[model samples]
Target: MRLSKLFKNAPTVNITGLCLDSRKVKKGDMYFCLPGMTFDGHDFIPQAIEKGAIAIVHSKDIIDKLPGVIYIQVEDVTACMNQCARLFYSKPSDKMTMYGITGTNGKSSCANIIKYIRDLKEPCGYIGTIAIEYGKVRIAPDLTTPDTLFLQRKLSDMVRAGMKSCALEVSSHGLSQHRVDGIRFDVAIFTNLTYDHLDFHGTIENYFEAKSILFKELVKEDGVSILNIDDDRYEDLKECSKARVVSYGIDQNCDYRAINIHENAKSTSFDLVYKGQKYPVKTSLVARYNVYNLLACIAALHETGMSLPVILQSCTKIPQIDGRMEQIECGQPFHVVVDFAHTPDGMEQMLRYGRQVAADKGRVITVFGSAGKRDIAKRKVFGELADKYADLIILTEDDPRDENPKDIANQIKEGIQNKPNLFVEDRYEAIRQAIDNASKGDVVLILGKGDEPFMYHESGRVPWTGDNICALECLKASGYGENNNS
Candidate 1:
């Protein structure tokens, strides 16, 4: 593809290779000068020119006057890059099966679950919180949904690598910013909408609008759209989309529903109902939300040409996604589950699931903290939900950024007026306290951090054990005090 194809309207500039980084610039590359939260890309324009950039695409400000370089100024560099990226990749999304899963939670899990099923029959690729994988090769992405050029390039690369199916996590930021524009979706899924990313998107409505863009813009003519009928936004999305729709929920009217759940310590078995028929499925994962996730995945695969029995078989052997209700046992007295339950809905769902497993003899002890410089409004809601369901709540730091960790903890405490809550500044120490305090038949929920590599605070991120590791260490050190194993 020539640079001429990208800016057919502009005509003057034509180039190959689009790079945002100066260090990666090649002779015929078009450099995009974007402004990041902390650093301005215009500052690196000189470095890009020095590296032999033939064409320059930048924001409104012309920081440097380069006499000979093919300079082009646009209203927004990010938007232009997303457009050019789609062009550069030859619109690879049009070539293969693409599944998009969005919402506050379950995006990654649903994407991975569907990928697990698809990979059993055909080469599958996934782009989500965990990593980007094409067949056996995996690459870590900085953001949930990468910038436009990177997005196109990666999809194009997947096509080159012979991937037949791809599942991607479509983030609200990506949708609002038009990062995923121009790609047609084979299946668009909504897990559920909740309070999240209020820092970027000002209100819940705005957040929903941003997330709705995936369905609004990309649902292809003949494509299938899988929706969680349980979410209130389902009707809104149904009205907005033009594609064929399949509804899945525990609700009676849903096209695909989980009629019943038989949950246990090791797994959860359920009867998956669809079109008046039912199939029995037992997954090695906990939580009723996971049952919903599984149903959505099943609906997506069925739309993508997979049989229900094969889909259920694929689900049976698939293990849990890390940091998503991951359980660790070392012959302990009680059960411990580590999860990334940051949102109110996620917290409530996890607790409800734990309650089912622990039964009457056990209590739910949760360790969690609100993130600094994030959706502050959700903190109180998180607290309220935790207070309502959890027997004991240990508030701790979760990516405090430059904000005071104690202040963040206090904010979460604001909503838990009636529940017993304890504050611990250190996440590791909080896990230790929760585990040490928990007795046999109890369920300790180490929440928030999940799979993060480090704990965040005003001091900045430091080397830290992941939530799973910290919980395991604490559980082991507890000497199996009150667990059933003893």
Candidate 2:
């Protein structure tokens, strides 16, 4: 494509591709010099030019301009990149039905559920923490919400592959950064927000504002905004959104309410009340929080023209989401659960469900740790929640990047008033100890780093088997097999 086609007012040049990282630059690629929190892309302009970049898009003036390469100056490189990416990709999002789900927790599960419902009628794609999947192609995501250029490119790919709908997990960071600026959403779902990502947003109010941008700006005027009415921020979100609002929750006043909720170790059944009608719904997903997720999914699907009867039927087949209260059973007498519950509220909810699974006959044992360089205040809170719920607690390393692992563990230990707790810096060893200590009818909950494939440290991101894999290995080592339970 010609550069003139992307930037009508700018100079004409043959544009082969678009890139943000200088290291990934190829011949004829237009390198975008975006300013980031840590490093400025403008600092790598010389390297990008060295790698045969034919054009440069930057916000600042270049003192030494390359003679042959085209230079396009913009007020904001991030905004410019978004526009250029949308134009270059032929605005693929406009060609398909798009759903954007935003919140601290349940975003991935809600996005996946929406994708699952949509795929029942037509081909659909998913972009979230687990993977970017469409048709037979699946790739691990580098970020929860990718940059605009990569996002638009992926959507374009999905459109070309005959996908009729796409589900996206929108993070607050992505919204504040304007990564989803140009894309129009057909349905925007707001899962409940909680105390997470404070290190970046600095305050809870700022976090809510960032999340509000999805409904305020991204969703089309005629689109639908599905909100959790039970959340405190629902009124604010509904007020800010220009689109039509549909509320869902356990609250009776909500547009869609879940009543007579029956949750057990394996599944939950509820009567979904919407518009003065009731539809019985059941799901294999565990936890009361997942009930909210199901409500959001039903509301979003209903807005997309799916009937209550059809949606209720589809609810019976909702697949178990990876890393969200996922179970690992190797014919062991005890049960093991792996979850990505790093926040204090998330941990409390997960442990509550773990207790239900343990049921009075068994003990609930929890193994979890906080990440470094994140909201440090949550460490002690996590400890308090663990102490309140779990019979035994194991503090271990969870991506202590550039911070001392022992110090992070110690911070978490400060809030435990009276509990049987042990500090284990090695994550794998912690899982081993937790499993080995568990007897028959015990429930072991491994929190943080769900389906994540790597562990971060000062050295770098090291290859590490996820919690599920480690728990399964320990179960095997403890002499449990498929035939052993019988």
Which candidate gets the maximum TM-score versus the true structure? 2
Candidate 2: Cα lDDT at 292: 95
lDDT of 1 at 417: 81
Candidate 2 residues lying further than 4 Å off, grouped into runs, are none
- Model 1: lDDT of residue 129: 78
Residue pairs with clashing backbones, model 2:
none
- Per-residue CA lDDT of model 1 for 91-178, tens digit only, reads 8998889999998999988998988889888988999777889967887667889877788888999999999889999999989877
What is the lDDT, from 0 to 100, of the residue 59 in candidate 2? Answer: 88
Q: Per-residue alpha-carbon lDDT of model 2 for 1-486, expressed as tens digits?
A: 789898877677789899999999999999999999899999999999999899999989898996998998889898888888989899999988999999888999999988898898889999999999999999999899998989999999999999999999999999999999978899999999999999999999999999999988854656999999999999999999989999999965789999999998788999988889888888888789999998999999888888778888888888877888888889887889999998887899999988887956799999999998999999999989998999999999999999998899899999898989999999999999999999888899999999899999999999889998899999899888887862
Q: Note the Cα lDDT for every prediction shown.
A: 0.84, 0.91
Worst 10 residues of 1 by lDDT: 476-485
- Give the TM-score (vs. native) of candidate 2: 0.98
